[model samples]
Target: MPTKIEKDSYTGTDTTGHEWDGIKELNTPIPSWWVWVFVASIIFSIVYVILYPAIPLTDSATQGVLGWSQRDTLATELAVRDEGRADITASISEADAAIVEQDHTLRTFALRGGAAAFAENCAPCHGAGGGGRPGYPVLADDDWIWGGTLSAIQETIRVGIRSGHDDERYAEMPAFADMLPQGERIAIAHFVAGLTGKGDPAKAAAGAVPYQDNCASCHGEDGTAVEDTGAPSLNDAIWIYGSDTGSILKQISNPQHGVMPAWEGRLDPVTIKMLAIYVHNLGGGLQEDAGL
Candidate 1:
């Protein structure tokens, strides 16, 4: 049932003739200011729709009266940025990596450009900061399998390791499990682990004989590794596969090699140069005077 409308005596306001206990409900009116704000919002929305995209359709939104688009704005901005960078990019192309590093403008441009390219391409395997994973070598550290010079890093990026490219850098260690007995393999594993001073010395002593006889040719007599052979150093704390004796034993049994993609044909020459410079600046690159 509808409540009858009446005037309340205590307050000069109209009330609905409905009472809860002794209190009557007041017929409150909406604020005039609020009503006007709501009307203004509706008008603004109509104006916005008329000036910019608003209505959605099957394939695209309605092209508004202004004839402007977000895509066009982005393209214009990118064109301006590229035009500004034309001279610096050309300088990077002509100069060597070391020469670029000496120039403030060229080095700054290369570092920023290289970081973007690395995130898109190299971050999947090498990590965002080049920390490396189980099979990948750390780029931020002093240790390197092939070398850590700028030229070395750049060349590796160009041809890649075991990539099947015509000029690819390739190296492989024979799986000793196919040739050696289990006992000798375990001994070699122990010896290799002990090179980092983390293995059982008792087993390591017995393992040394087998290690020298079979593994020392490429891994070196002291387990320091032969970089030319791409054999990782056992003497260092940095281990690409694993540092533990168990992982070492597994590798001794059946080695697993990693392959890097050749970027020479995939990336532009300038991009490749920038990527090389970026990697070299990651706190581990050797100077020209520093021999491998």
Candidate 2:
């Protein structure tokens, strides 16, 4: 028990009758506003518990009187949003991507929507701005291995290359390690490196014959690339692996065959169309009758 209960000199408040050492605690009443607030909080908690989920059960959470949930709220919001976009979505779904591109409004919508989709789905391998990573071709350039026309771009996005789809753009650059002699392949590598005008001249000249015999069938004789064969142009500076001699040699010995997943089944048609439009407008698109 306390030593004594008496009025304190400071502000004349009574002591709690509880003392520790020489100090005594004042038994001051709580402010009326504070007491009211505390009571109100307790009441609010009781009401909230009854009106909203407050307890956890074994299989599920408690179903409160209001029966409201964040899941339901989100579903309602999404429904409203989808309804608002119904007309535009329908128009995009119905129209061909080429036709959609003609309409300024549709093109604008597709570009914005495609950017969002690309960020989530295509940015991992293709890069955020379609700059492309190693083994992935740069989408922002005019060096498309397949083709760069709007229709061609759309088809590639739909079926993909070497993606196991029945209609896939299939082309296999044979590994020359087993087929060709080591010296001959090295000569060819030097020749390919020089095609971009940066390799050893002596080796490149010696490589010309061997390159003609083996590589000219797929990659053009001048290394201009055969689009039908999915061969990349060797004369340009847009090398996927590297522009170095070592990179060329490695590719000749064992090529890195890239695979792009088919978006036909994975994404809806409208989304695929928009993606093709977005990629085409990345400064690589060509006129329908234009040569690569």
Candidate 3:
């Protein structure tokens, strides 16, 4: 039988007619405020489902009554941004690269754009500020294997060195390992290393004759390098391979040839022009006439 409901004598409260060791069970009702709050939450959820995208289907989600979408919002914002940049982009596209450098505003925009592009595309091999890695050339220094003029920099960025592009600037040092005797190679390395004043005097003297006969054609007799042949100066402290005697010897035996990819078709003209401008301003850029 069901337990009978009755009032308890101790506190005048209603209790079910069931007890465990003389303690009766009380039937308490939920608070009205809590019940109403729970009901409100259910109602709010229904309203939200109707107002915004809630249910997902096989191909897409429910398009709510408001018709709002994250993609549309992003597109609208991008359109606004593009509108703002339209004039600047047009100016850059139309103007000659050299003429663009003469305008302060245009030059500033190019520098900023170029820095961003360089960081994204060029910073992997060249350091963040064009400091250069082991095989890469230091862009911020005056010791350019090719020329360092603004036009030169632009052309280099466009076609690249040793790249497969038709107009690429190409140069290669003949590997002397097979052609020259081991003693001659070592002597030449010593002579070349001594050009920077860091080699053994006795070894350098012994190597002088070999160097004059074989290496002097491209790298001038004075070791100052002929820029046209892309021969780097041996007399300078800057060593592309390295400054140590061992490194010089390795280069003499089998030289390292670094290749850079052409950016002409890959990047837009405006971007390439900007990159040239940015690289040119990096501490060691030459004036037009001076570089030529």
Cα lDDT of model 1 by residue, 1-292, tens digit:
3376788777878987787776778987889999999999999999999999989999999888997899999999999999999999999999998898889989999999999999999999999878787798889899878788888888899999999999898989888888999988887888888888888888888898899998888899998887588888889889888889889999988998999999999999889989989999998988767856
Ranking of predictions according to TM-score = 2, 3, 1
- Top model number, lDDT: 2
What is the Cα-based lDDT of residue 282 in candidate 1? 94
Tens digits of per-residue lDDT, candidate 3, 28-140, equal: 66799999999999999999889888899999999889888899999999999989989998898899888788899999999999999999889899898999998888889
Cα lDDT of all candidates, in order? 0.88, 0.89, 0.88
The whole-model C-alpha lDDT of candidate 3 against the native structure comes to: 0.88
What's the TM for model 2?
0.94
C-alpha TM-scores of all predictions? 0.83, 0.94, 0.85
